[model samples]
Target: MMEATTQAEVTAYWNARAPAFDGVASHVAQGGVWRDVLAAAFGAGGPRDVVDLGSGTGACALIAASLGHRVRGYDGSEGMLAVARAAAEAAGLSVSFDAAVIDQAAIEPASADIVTLRNVLWTLEQPMVALAQAHAALRPGGMVLVSDGLWSVAPQFRSTYDPALAARLPWHGGLTEADARRMLAETGFGDARSWQHLFASPPYPGDVPMFVLSARKA
Candidate 1:
């Protein structure tokens, strides 16, 4: 299990990287690809309430807000939240960005229509706890959208974190679509589904395998 000290280390690591985080293609709002992908996953909806956990730089949160959804984004790194808030202001998008750990975010139960975890699960110390939090945050029939990749295969994965700390993360090596689906189901979600075509031609290098998983609250 991840200790409180290790969690603080993880947050510090992310805070150090927050400034240049958006330089990565996948971390920013990619013209139409991300917008379209989120729209499809969110389904036909009108101004739904969205809670974005691990909302680094507010990419997905901003996109969701732009699509008319009311979005609240939470991240453990204060530096990241600063960047996200600045981005939201620049985009004229009304998104509330707060500092909070993924698994311990202070959100009201069943208050959200959608919860998003984009490329965040693999880095989490307790991904199952985060999923449970997502489950509790969503209203009945609400959706949780998760996007991540087989980051272990990427050449730079080893350099992204401290070797010792990385070794402790449950999914630091990465996870598959099947793993995500199973986790969602185990967390009391139903109608779980996955998609891969959205990342068939990744914008970044390494050709890391990516997937998008969406499931409804049971």
Candidate 2:
């Protein structure tokens, strides 16, 4: 289990990479994992009260809102949250953005029908704790979705990222499919499953996997 990430480091890292991250997002929406991730997460469900954790720039949150899900986005980075707010406004959608860590977030328990933790599991210092918090935030029979997969093959990882990006990459908690499911289950989630699409072969982006870990409060 990883310890809590310092706010300063996380802020500095994201602050420095904000522009690069935004550029990547635009590119992803054009032809990449962004659409697939959003589709897999929201396309199958009806309108839901959704929370997009680590929702940088409101891509998923805005999309979900457009699909009629009342969405709230959470992130630890203020700079990122600013971008998300602007994006939401530009889309003419109303989404509540929370600038806080998962555990420290002010959201009450059993308030949301679905809680989204996209591309954040592997980046968190305390993934299990984050899942537990998400579980608590959702209503009975709510859902939690986690997505990640920057690298599928070992040698291929080197080709995708340079040293700085590689070093500061979202999180150190990257787990395989089995471990990911196990983490959710261990943290009080039921019916955990992972789905993935490997787009750029092994030497590029690897697999953009989706882990939808859902549970009904018993």
The 0-to-1 C-alpha lDDT of every candidate, in the order given, reads: 0.85, 0.66
lDDT of each residue in 62-141, candidate 1, tens digit only: 99999999999999999989999999999999999989897667899999999999888888788999999999999999
Alpha-carbon shift of residue 12 in model 2 (angstroms)? 1.5
Please give the lDDT score at residue 97 for candidate 2. 94
- Model 1 gets an lDDT of 0.85
Residues 1-218 of candidate 2: C-alpha lDDT, one tens digit per residue? 23344445655666666555766543344434545545665557677888888887666787778777888899888888888898788879999998887778888889888787766776665677788888888888787777554334433432233444445544443556676777777877776644454333321244343243444443
TM-score of each: 0.94, 0.78
Estimate the lDDT of model 2.
Answer: 0.66
